[model samples]
Target: MNAFEINGGKPLRGEIIPQGAKNEALQVISAVLLTEEQVIISNVPDIKDVNKLIELLGDLGVRVEHLKKDTYSFQAKDIDLDFFMSEQFKAKGGSLRGSIMIVGPLLARFGKASIPKPGGDKIGRRRLDTHFLGFEKLGAKFNYNSKTNFFNVDASHLKGAYILLDEASVTGTANVIMAAVLAKGITTIYNAACEPYIQQLCKMLNRMGAKISGIGSNLLNIEGVEKLGGTEHRLLPDMIEIGSFIGLAAMTGSEITIKDVHYNELGIIPDIFKRMGIRLKLRGDDIYIPSQPHYEIDTFIDGSILTVADAPWPGFTPDLLSIVLVVATQAKGNVMIHQKMFESRLFFVDKLIDMGAQIILCDPHRATVMGLDKQVQLRGIEMTSPDIRAGVSLLIAALSASGRSIIHNIEQIERGYQDIDIRLRALGADIKRINTMPKQH
Candidate 1:
């Protein structure tokens, strides 16, 4: 296994660019399957998950070409539908959660789609109910094979209809929107996810001749067309990464500038950090974080303690809560970190507690963190990363702690962040990547 050996207590400095949005890349890449013409995408993050998806696409006969770094052209004129039923797909398709999204475009264009049980971070139960139900709403037949652990959706003629999602699930909305764009009628989606990723997807589809309205709201109207054409799209900078860097700068007392953040699309992220007393300066399209020796958490106007929590779009993203919680460990005052969306995400706080931070794990969803207030420095310790976000959060913690720290299972971090060690090294972080085998006793 590979691990990161980090020498902590050194502040990172210099400018780092946030990678293209991983989540958006997944959604947009799947959208390429909707058109037989060439769909060119730029700003694609070269990460493990995305590369895996691209391999899957190539396996299905999509003409994939690397035009340049961070840019690619995909044409699915000769798809191999038989590949979906092959044993190879059974192994590969089940390895990534993004593989499930291919069902939408395939069902839209080819009238049928199938995928093995999708796998992702074990943060919590990520159900595919929304995607399947939305497909059924648009005149598709859904079935699950218990014997093979696969999902199948078929629709010979899709006629769009109204869909009100249980939750504004981002991938679900994207799947249904992709399907609806080529359906027979109008599809109205209420309670839809309006995150920047979804907005970009809508805009890209519109450019490809799909009629979609209500770009940045909870309700979206899509008019089905006969076919979609090729279009070019560029992904937004990853907001989660930007948020992580902000927390990293504060925790390690580093002066850092995150370049090309696409600031207007950051929603409530910057304001949320401001609530934790971290100062941020917006310069054109970048975010500059000055070195902070100490930052005090804010209290509510009613004299109540501050609570940082995750919500749907336009609210704090659940993906960044781990970074926020870790940063809170060194801030002044106490705050409650509530991870309502995922039950198991807050369990990582136990690792922070082991490093001499004061944290009370109230339950699976809530934790009360009493900040160290820069009065004490955390001592580095060995730990294993449980998920992508948690891995980066631990890396940030290690960078701000004293002594040496080793992080195992760094592959989880690489699944999302592209060239993380190289990027962090550019910012003067004392981190080294190493491979090791377990010692036999």
Candidate 2:
């Protein structure tokens, strides 16, 4: 494992290029299983989860060839469904929520599919009901084995029907859409997850010659294609990384500019952060974050404390909540951070509070942060990462602390941020990445 040692209280000031979107890449890579044709995806981020997923796909018998640093071409001409149905399946694909998506597409195409329990951020209980609900509506029978932690979906010539998801579960919507894209008849997904992730998946499917209507809307009408052929598509820039950078610049009191961000693709992220008293300059496709010597949270019209919350698309991303929560600690005023998607997410505030941050954990999903305390600063200390987002948040907190800090479990941080230590060090942050060994007993 690797750990980051950060000497804090340093202002990070430099131009940082955001990496490719991890969430979008996860779904885009899985889209390869939809066709055996050669699919070339570019601008891919080099991260643990993405690499692990690529490894899982390789295990599935997909011919994955690296074209360049951030580009790869894959052809699933030799997809072995049995690879995903083994005991190893429980330890492999079931560990990633994205891998579970393979089941729906495989079942629709091969008439049978098996997947182990899916894994991702252990933020909270994110169920696959919406996904299975979509599968059942598409004429597939799901046999979930709790003991084996596998889902066996079998069906012959799936007949599409009206499919409405319970929630806009991102992966669920993706899995359902993948299955329905090649069904016998029309499939309608109501109240679907239309985030950038789902949008990119729909676009990739469309580029591959699948008839999917409502590219950016909740009602997705996937007209089952006879067969999807391979077509090349570029992965979207990592918007979450972009947002994370925005928060990082604000907290560091640095005037940093982000280059090559598709401003239009970001929806309302720029405007939402403005509510936190973070002003950004959007010129063409780039974003400029100016240094704020006295950063503060903006109050509501009636003088109530500002509250930053996350919602579906056209709203702030839940992934960036941890970053924003840390940023709020340095802002001038108080603001409540509400993360409805995950419960364990807000638990990291205790670690922040230990560093002298005035964060009141109202509950499992909400935290009230009183910033700066007029004369207080977060001091650096040694800490362990609990999850990916929290790990990155701790890194940000460590950078802003008064002294040196050591962060363990950097693999969690690496799972999302691509070359994060190098990227942050470029911005004048004294961060060093070193491989660590467990203490011998």
Per-model CA lDDT versus the true structure: 0.93, 0.84
Model 1 local distance difference test score:
0.93
TM-score of each: 0.99, 0.96
Question: Candidate 2: lDDT over CA atoms?
Answer: 0.84
RMSD of each: 1.2, 1.8
Model 1: per-residue Cα lDDT over 173-279, one tens digit each: 99999999999989999999999999999999999999999999999999999999999999999999999999999999999999999999999999999999999
Query: What number of clashing residue pairs does each candidate have, in the order they appear?
Result: 0, 5
**How do the residues 35-72 of candidate 2 rate in per-residue lDDT, one tens digit apiece?**
88999999999998888889888988999999999999
Best TM-score among the predictions, by candidate number: 1
Q: Give me the runs in candidate 2 sitting further than 4 Å from their true place.
A: 435-441
